[model samples]
Target: MTITGRCYCGELTYCIESEPIMKGNCHCRECQYFSGGHPNAFLVMSDSTFQYTKGKPKTFTRSDLEKPRTREFCGNCGTHICTKSEFRPGAIVLKAGTLDDMSLFDKPDMAIFTIDKQPFHHLDADVPSYERMKP
Candidate 1:
């Protein structure tokens, strides 16, 4: 199934040509920062199936981290689009908020990095939770 999405400003857009391999919520500290103090909902898909359909995204990777995931965002709107990591090679994590049809992401299959989860972060009781990255 093909999925389409764009940034808040519509400056950067993308198309996903395949169904997501995994749907999950990340409560990592970094994700909290990116999502404005909440867990980040995302879908993992084959990198080959994802591509930009519009303007290029500005990328950022923390040099301080030994293993840093690269975040791609709209340079104009600063809307984080997707993330790439060497640890999860061949997969790309797309932010759920960027989806043109948000309904497609009804629920997360799992929640990761719960160690950093705050009391205010509401996690679905039915969803599996991990203290750290799923391994």
Candidate 2:
């Protein structure tokens, strides 16, 4: 399945030529901060099938972490686009909200980092949830 997306300001665009390897929500503190106090819905896609179709995105990797996940975002709009992790090489974690068709990620396959999930953060009863990262 081909998926097309762009940043909020349309400064950066991307295309995913393959299906996602995983679809889930992350409730980690970092995700909550980036997502404005909510769990981050994401699609894990193969790096080989993803490409920037327009302008380049700015990237950031926390200097404090020994092994930090690299975040890619629109420099102009500050839209969180995708993230690349050293632990999950060859995979790009795309922010579901950035997709042109948001309905494609209607439900998460799982909800992770629940240990850090806030009291106000609600997940569907049927959505499998993990206290931390799924093994």
Candidate 3:
């Protein structure tokens, strides 16, 4: 299936031509901070499937952590597009909220980093929860 998405300012747009390999909700501290303090829905697609159809996205790499993650966003609107990390090579993590059609992807298969998840935030009981990350 093909997936299309763009940043808020429309400066950055991308298309994933292959089916995603993973889908999840992340509640890591970094995710919370980046998403303005809430879990972020994500779809992990093969790097080969991703293509930047519009302006190139600006990236900021987080080096302070054990596994440095790279966040790619639109320079104009500051809308985060995706994240990359050594933990999952040859893959790109799409911020589900940026998707042009939310239903384009399947429901999250899991919820990760529940240890740092906000207690007030409700989670899907049907999806398995991981204290840190799914192994």
Best by lDDT: 2
**Which pairs of residues collide in candidate 1?**
none
lDDT at 27, model 2: 99
Give the Å error, residue 91, model 1.
0.8
lDDT of 1 by residue, 1-57 (tens): 999999999999999888988899999998999999999999998888788999999
**Candidate 2 has what TM-score?**
0.98
| Rank by lDDT (best first) | 2, 1, 3
Where does model 1 exceed 4 Å of error? none
Assess each prediction's global lDDT (C-alpha) against the native.
0.94, 0.95, 0.89
Candidate 1 Cα lDDT to native: 0.94
Residue pairs clashing, model 3: none
Prediction 3 TM-score vs. true:
0.94
Candidate 1 lDDT score at position 53: 96
Off by over 4 Å in 2: none
Better of 2 and 3 by lDDT: 2
**In terms of TM-score, which candidate is stronger, 1 or 3?**
1
Error of 1 at 131 (Å): 0.6
- Candidate 1 local Cα displacement, residue 39, angstroms: 0.4
